[model samples]
Target: MDVNRRNEMKKVIVSVKLRDILIGILIFNICIVIFSLIVVGVNKGNRQLKYGNTENKQIEHNNSKVDLDLKKEKDTILNKKIDSCINLYLTREKRIVKLDLEQYVLGVVSAEMPANFNIEALKAQAVAARTYAVCHTKHLVGGGCSLNANADICDSVHCQAYISQEKRMKTWPKKERAELYNKVKEAVESTRGQVLSYDGELVMNPYYFATSSGKTENSEEVFKESKPYLKSVESPGEEVAPKYKTQFKFSNANFTTVMNSQFKGLNLNSNIIKDKINILERSQGGSIKQIKIGNITTTGKMIRKLFGLPSANFTISFESTNIVFNCKGYGHGVGMSQWGAGVMAREGKKYDEILRHYYSGIEIKTLNYK
Candidate 1:
């Protein structure tokens, strides 16, 4: 090689070594500083831990690690309440739950049905509801307390269910009921936030809101404490049939007024009437003849019943079995008829669409946990 090239190469090598040495020395100094800081901190922490003000001391968290372990303590507690729901996994292997945050939020807001539900199906339903709330709350799972097994889902506040062991199993399936319960419990814990929650409070969904004497549901005026406690039920019927098969004074007027609350003076539109008018006892009453809307004949017994009434004071449209003229407020005379939101989702209906319909002002989002 040439002398100039060799000199240049030698100079570059020397410069490189000098740079590395300087960098190494700087790194060593930083490490020493960090070590000294850590030792000083540890000494201070140990002193406080061993002889801190006794009166002001807390439960004596051994270390920062214990202070961050609130999630396990909470899980130990909630697990005890619902021991039957089916198990689910965050992944295919089933290491963690699939529905976490949804469970927590829902747990604080809902509760299980009567003890005769299909646990697996109930768990699936809880997952779906979690899917719904996850969207609405804008919160995801697997983020520690932000989303964990600290929540309860598969509850009645979000959906109605039978309560009381005997009453629940009376008509529900045996195998299916157990399966649903077990599946739900597992699914709820497998994922993050699978229960009802609101603000900072962990709302335990008190099932079955009570109403007036014969009326069990008056959403606005619920029997706060009498909430249902059972877990799941395999079968659910259209509104539980009245105890007495035959009514002593059954009339369309009474059905619309007392049962449904419909009348000409009601001034409610066709949509409102449709929302509230349900046939709870179709197989056990007289047939309704006709109904008129502004002198126009509407379809079925609806229009006919409207024609005869004084518009303000309702009258019995009919009364008998096989075609019970039941004038109920709301179409799905069954469970949790969303006469309110049902009027909305119909403009465009999807599964999520139906969810937003019943649950007031909520969103729809999917789950993703790592």
Candidate 2:
């Protein structure tokens, strides 16, 4: 009985030892799996952190670019404003007027064109006047138009007709002054910084006139230089001008004396004056190109100046004791016709259209000093 009991005890002890060994193996496998999971989780966290840093860098770079663009835009605008400011000389006052370029343009438009004209016409005038000022400023830099050496421009018809607000008020009716002033001011403000350009450059000469003689004249015909944009164009419906058809009469003796004195080489004989007068050539626009008086050939421009004629489009005839001059228009007939612009504006043309109608192949550009 003692041997049997000892065998049972030995069997129990072996079974218990086997069970402890199996538990130990299972615990080792579980520890291996836990270590692998921890390594994988740590790698994932590292990747996320790197990606987050890259994303933040991209956002910061985008923000920096936006700020740089805004700053550049602001600088450009500031430069433009500074460039637009020009110095003007009021010749009548004999003083320099430090006015904004747009304000000077306003004064020019008001004094140059009638305040009662169409809004579009007024805008066109404003652009033209501004362009004229810019061209003069450039000319001033190049040592041209030296009448006012210390000025960007002079305030005269020689440059551009300019009237101060105080003078304009004095000239206008007390009740209507405010309304007229506002009308001009609106036109200038609406077309601020606008100018006419040809071939990507500003036009040096922006000639304008009160009326055209049926058509506008070529620049070559009037100014001896052909400007492609100032080519002759039809300007109809200017018959409504107050002095469209003016008749000037002078005594034969007086006319002969004036002609003889004006024409440097001409010696006039009163008896043969009627026979010697001749219109040698006419421009395509029908203005007298050249005239022959006795032995001297002179331009119609000279004759117009000598006789105080309204325009070069005139027909001279000897009628008994007087020389009759039947004139058609009232200016140099070079570029923009104010009356034609008015008629076009009245007929529902915009300011740009009016400008294109008068100035051929031109671009209306806002002067960007930047």
Candidate 3:
């Protein structure tokens, strides 16, 4: 009976221990499952944050590209506006030619002035040419060249000498053509869209001429009209011009015939004509303002034309073989003298200084074409 009791006790104790061990294993497995679930949830949240950041960066890059495109579009629109305002010009060939304003000025400069002149002198010429063009457009009131009613100005010096690029290329030597063209083009571009004004008004007629004898003439003296800007001013250093001093000799018969033909009322006695030709008055520029031939009193301009004299600044003398006219200067001796400007530029005078010296009380301003 004792042996039976002991065996029953041993079985009960073993069964209890086995149940505790099973319970411990079940608890450990449950804890491992809960930890695994928590770790997986945390990993999923980190992946979503990384994805969101990558999308935000892509959106910022896309926005930057859109901004750059908008800027480029704006720049193109601005360029068109500038072109529309400046690319309309009329040509003498009865044609409406489209040319950039600066380019037109370059052609005019190349034609109207020597290419070898100083850069500052060329710049001054460009500004003057531009102002002249703008002024003509305003004064024309939509009118055009007298010869061509549809043209703004002729390609001749009668208006402003303008040579086309094709003509320039044909006329200039092949090696020198591009260099000469660039020189003039640079002058125009450097002073692009610049014009001259006086008392807040655009200068309509800025006259310029070749070499002056010693001084520029007053507008009243030359044109019979006073212009405040065009005043008598001493122009030095023009004596260096090649034709600054020239002489014209005419045979007695030729001189008499020319004089009689021009003035029908006059009968010239060749023997006494030398004594009769006398300068009565001289302008401030030392040009012959008035002269007396026999009993006819006329302006020096008439004598210059009748005798084919280069300028009105001359002294008549009788040579053993012919009547000689010793002349000075080449043109009307009015406004800005080309040779004078060259000299001034060589002396380190800027374009503005040169212009102010010639055109008194003037202002250099930007083109205000509406």
Candidate 4:
């Protein structure tokens, strides 16, 4: 029965066992591959769901953060290109001090606009002040302070008001100084190296004032020069400003004396002042343009300066023995009104939106030195 039959059987048994083991290994390998494919598919779907639809993809919140970071980085690079110094003349100190342009912008923003204003409004003011400084930079643009040839600008309202950080700290209450300064600094830094330009040229005159009489004046009406961007525009929601409406009263004798002193050869009777004074022409923004008094035609601006009035948008009224001038708004009423900007900011307008509203046909461009 025998050795050959036994050896054949043993070989058959071994071959069958080997085939079973091979099949089992193949099945295990297939299961491993299938499990990996399933895991990968699940991960892909989760990624898609987290990101958004593939056809119309939406950014995740983190993506927005990344975009903001990139924008900040870009702004940092732009600011680095313009890290130049400015020579600012201190009018009270009668000295010229040089500082970084961005720092100067910070000072100007802190000085020109109230620190408690909305951040967007402060940003708008920062850009405007930066534009003014860059436009008047002596070496950069061939413009300088008229009073001081050695200085690029003066810390006077005639230019753009600027106060050092030390001075600003002193001006504000002790508890509010640090917070206010940080707010101003954030505004300037957020808009670093940005300026307003009209038709590819920097805005030469970015004039702004405290308030307006419902609307801003045209450049031609206020400065006698036509500026396309500085046209008449409505400035609403400024009635809440402190200087919205003011009054100046002068006795008939005092009024007559003041008028006669400015307009020589004019003899006016105090009793008939109301009848003799007449407003002949008014600007589109309701600012008095021309007025005649005792056969003398004078400009409203001249009268405003002579009498130290807040603005030229005034109405005349006779009160017993006194001549009363009711003035609406303040400053020159030719550009962006600070109070108006605050209103816009409160209504959720962005800084660029506020700037574009006041300065028409302008672009907010990043400064490039090269």
TM-score, every prediction: 0.26, 0.75, 0.72, 0.77
- Which 10-residue span in candidate 4 carries the lowest summed lDDT? 74-83
The local distance difference test score of model 2 is: 0.83
CA lDDT, every prediction? Answer: 0.35, 0.83, 0.78, 0.89
Which structure among the candidates has the greatest lDDT?
A: 4
- Per residue, candidate 4 scores C-alpha lDDT tens digits across 1-370 of 6999999999999999999999999999999999999987997877664344653445456688886764554444335465468899999999999988899999999889999999999999999999899878876666799979999999999899988899889989999989999999999999988898776666778889999999999989989999999988999999999999999998999989988887788999998888999999999999999999998998889889988999999999999999899999999998788999999999999999999999999889888644
Candidate structures ordered by lDDT, highest first: 4, 2, 3, 1
lDDT of 2 by residue, 226-344 (tens): 99989899989989999788999999889889888876768887777888889999887778999988998888888898889999999988788888999998999988999999989
* Per-residue alpha-carbon lDDT of candidate 1 for residues 218-272, written as tens digits (9 for 90 to 100): 1222222322221111112223423212222333344444323443455433333
Each model's total of backbone clashes: 87, 0, 0, 0
Report the C-alpha displacement of residue 298, candidate 4, in angstroms.
0.8
Instruction: Tell me the deviation in Å of residue 113 in model 3.
Output: 1.3
For model 1, the stretches where C-alpha displacement exceeds 4 angstroms are: 1-102, 105-112, 138-183, 190-317, 320-366
Determine the C-alpha RMSD for candidate 2 after optimal superposition of all C-alphas: 22.8
Q: lDDT value for candidate 4? A: 0.89
lDDT of 3 at 77: 31
lDDT of 2 at 128: 93
